[model samples]
Target: MAVPGAFVSSILLLLASAAVAEIQFSEIRSDDRPIIPLDDFGFTHRGWLELNVSGIALSKAGLELGNLGFFLCTRDSWLNVLKELEEEDITCALQSSHVKHVFTFEKLGQRTSFDVEFDQEDANQYTLIFANCLQQQLRVSMDVRSAMYNLDGKSGRRDYLSAGKTILPRVYYLFSLIYFVLAGLWVYVLYKKRLTVFKIHFFMLAVLIMKGLNLLCEAEDKSYIKRTGSAHGWDVLFYIFSFLKGITLFTLIVLIGTGWSFLKPYLQDKEKKVLMIVIPLQVVANIAQVVVDETGPYGQDWVTWKQVFLLVDVVCCCAVLFPIVWSIKNLREAARTDGKAAVNLMKLTLFRQYYIVVICYIYFTRVVVYALETITSYKYLWTSVVAAELATLAFYAFTGYKFRPEAHNPYFAIDDEEEEAAAEALKLEDEFEL
Candidate 1:
């Protein structure tokens, strides 16, 4: 063995050449870069590319590949990839229990390759080895780009929401703007009418306008967090608007559902009491949702309290059913006696039923879609919700406009007659006392 010094030197030289030959480095130093659009043209071209890239190379280069695509998560390349993999709890399966401190290297140009063969047949073993080599900053001569060329599929298509960006429909925002204008006009009309019956109509229109504004804000900016790096304020406003809309709907339902002359005073008091209790509870629940669930920086758990508020809202809605039944019974009794009161009651009842029918349609559609994933895309679901809301509001506004109180044909003419009768009864009681 001592007599083979020349042979030993030759063997060392051969090993060095083989190590250098494994990777070929080439660099093109011209500015003629390819312009890639964000969409696919045909089968030949694509917007994204995917290949089984080495994670070690990605860590060293300060890039990471996730379902969301490539991200330069941090300036520290090696730390960034490790952190990302650790977050997924995948880095603990490395072949080496600890990364080796001493690692070989060669300084070459770009286009690095790992032509070295491995005995491990498991593909994940190779990934672990690459991760270890990267952690040690070993012989990665040039930038090793193991990232797969992928078609950055930005389509929001999935059974459940996936990491993707979706283009929002602008038409919904335009329609929401129109809805806002119409709601505002109806509110003005209600103000001009100056009748107690139309006050509920005014409140309902106001809530609809707020909901439209919330939709418009979401359309303007789809980001959960804002450009200012702050939590979105519009989300809190949305919850408030939604809660108010629900409460106002219940109030209107109770008002129109109880169409009896004898029991009208008691039912009106009950509506006021319901508002007094429900409004505060709704406000508090919405505030809790905003602080803890919606735009909160902490645990964004919406399921627990979301169901609670929804249950409260549903109960309030269902409570109106009894009033509606009683009102129908009262109307049938009144029809046998007072023709005019019964006619007005029937008209109001029809309007209320129409409103409830439209609301029920929307509620049922949303519940079904959300529960069973009937609609594949959440973006489309949002659009449908806005469309439903706008359509319902338009129909309600049309009905109110058509049957608005006027001097020639007042919608609630019985109200004035009833007030006159009450005043006459009071005068007779005073005369009897005298």
Candidate 2:
């Protein structure tokens, strides 16, 4: 038994050493020139290059123009693609110049075949196209092929194609459907009887329509059709409309703030003023971000400007959300102090039904995610926006059910009594002054 055990141990040790030796050999072999010539035109005619499978390579190359060879330089690009595939459970690939020039794939087999073809008869110019090969999987590939071909004019075409066919159109149609349904329902409720909450709901519906229109315009422009959606006037309008979308958030903040102010009348004057001040400041900052993004260093230095805007927007959002949440908490405490159980129940009911506020919070969180994606250029972040909007629409639709005139009568009566008391107090003060 001891002899057998000793023999087994010796075999395991030998296998481990052999594995280490193979790894070391691979590292050494990978150092050799990546490009191997099948035909002897050595420097002149470059042929299909096979990636070295022995070792890991970086993500992107430092040198721009060179013979197609196996090397990776930008680590983030490769990691990002892998992460998207893993996290989303979707197949992904590098298709165009937007991603790094190098492509990375997990070694699944001995060899993987890639097909290449040139459209125009220019030996100097060749396009290296990467397509999705995963069976029954949605693959999102970056627009990175133009860089490989050195095709200046056609650089944006493939990306635009993918955006039109897959991304933008889908988003546009989904949002449009949601907007129409919610808007129609709200209009029907208004015809039955007007509700103040429905006004805000309608406003939200309008926002959805505006967003859908903007996306539609973008999609139409990118689609490769006869009329190449190139209306510069419309483009300018879209830019302005995007800026307005950011401003609209401030409007929501104001609406929520006013609602909170009504619920908490004892808030310090200074705090109230500060909250008001933050609203316009946030609006200005958001507009400035759009301007800077369109006309300033953002065009030249995307990464830096993206980070700056994200930081600013995040700070502003936190500044706004914090006070509102604090005010809501204070209101809840104050409601508890009311002596009558009936009054407390009414207050709790009103508070619980503030789905508008909840929807707005959801919207704010979505904005943060959108801003982060803009900075990081992560494609997956877009799906979050779609989900958020869908949720907001659904919440608003449900909230509309409580818009009957009878529901507001109780609150309105209370409001009238308060107004009468305030008027009487004011008359007393005026008489004393006289």
Total clashes for model 2: 14
Tell me the spans in candidate 2 whose CA falls farther than 4 Å from its real position.
1-159, 163-165, 195-233, 260-301, 326-330, 333-341, 349-385, 395-434
- What would the TM-scores of all predictions be? 0.47, 0.47
Backbone clash count for every predicted candidate, in the order shown: 13, 14
| Candidate 2 C-alpha error for residue 240, in Å | 2.3
lDDT values for all models:
0.38, 0.38
Candidate 2 local lDDT, 394-432, one digit each (tens): 544554444332425454355545645534443343211
TM for candidate 1 is 0.47
